[model samples]
Target: MSSPPPLPERVSAVATLDDPVRRSLYELVSQSPVPLGRDAAASTLGLSRSTTAFHLDRLAEVGLLAVEFRRLSGKTGPGAGRPAKLYSRADGEICISVPARQYDLAGELMAAAISESGQSGEPVLDTLARVAAHAGRAIGAASADLSSALTANGFEPRAEDDGGIVLGNCPFHRLAETHTAVVCSLNYQLLCGIADGAGDAAHTIVADPDAGECCVRAVPVPQIPQ
Candidate 1:
């Protein structure tokens, strides 16, 4: 007659429920200590057996939920009631920290803004500051979809008062450290795009490109290549 232990906090959690019933079921399961069986999930969600099963299946289909078979301890019927099926988080499935949309657009937008800003005096640092600020605007004002995309993929960016986008979460760094070309390319393009928007007449976005590190570094002082 004792309650189960509390479940972990919703850390990097994914909620994939279109129906109220299924969504309610996910909320309950997410908060539950013990892995919830179909019956328990249905009861807690105030849904009928058939309805609950349908929702569970939907979650499973979307790669959010998984089914486990546990032996029934006290059931008297045949086959231990088919080895109770329990619903829980899908194990071993990776969730990208940063999302794809940011991948495609953030860097490009940043590059535009930075490039558009004229009067970017010498010194790579000053130029980058301008670019960061321009990019930060898009970073902060991004819609939920954009935000989610950014966070889910690998560039969990944060805003700083001094006008910068801090790399809050780096899913790309985590998942693809060995090869960051795609992410780097995408980010550089966006940063360049931002500069482009800002109107940086002399310099261009590809000046920096995606070098190692967090924020996009400035393209090296333009020099006549020998």
Candidate 2:
């Protein structure tokens, strides 16, 4: 599965729809049972083909619309002419929030946990912890560094003078507020997995919940004497 766009990208893509013409084109294409060609869209909106095509392409550039070329006529290659460009709504979801909420990520993790628990006969919470950690590990491994990984996941990581890290925002803030114990535990496990996957053994993730911040902190790992 593919990850959703970063918050900024999603916000920008959504902002493109603020244009009245573009918004109308998007609505028309999305609501239609089938993809629409530029000519068809132009006729329906009472606009010139050039104007409609420009706005449609603009929407596609922002990832709000999908584009494909096909021959509207049910004819073969003999002399079918050029394929028409059809536009439709793109796949995937776009969500934007001021503080950045990731209820969708939380829901995905929980759903996976439930499915695995049902199959393996394991406790749901235990399965949830495992899956969340696995997800974090993937994020860390794919990112260029720890900070990038955290930022990508909406953790909003900040570096401390002592070489520690503080999370300015919790992606799962809403869920954590309602289900403190479960969500916090999941948060800790996920961070630990991120550290492991990032191959940064110097940091240890600990639950140190504070108001308006993530429930966990990344502190320097304690040294062990041989």
Best by lDDT: 2
Off by over 4 Å in 1: 1-16, 74-79, 91-226
Q: What TM-score fits each model? A: 0.38, 0.94
lDDT of 1: 0.51
What does candidate 2's lDDT look like per residue over 10-38, in tens digits? 88889999999999999999999999999
The 10 consecutive residues of candidate 2 with the worst lDDT sum are 1-10
The candidate scoring highest on TM-score is: 2
CA lDDT, candidate 2, residue 198? 81
Spell out the clash pairs found in candidate 2: none
Task: Give per-model CA RMSD.
Answer: 16.4, 1.8
Q: What are the per-residue Cα lDDT tens digits for candidate 1 across 1-226?
A: 0111111212223445556776787777767777788888777667799988888887776666777878647666665666778888666343332222233233443354456554454444345454544554354344233333234334444544543344554333432355455445445544454445434343333423233345353332355879
- lDDT value, candidate 2, whole model: 0.86
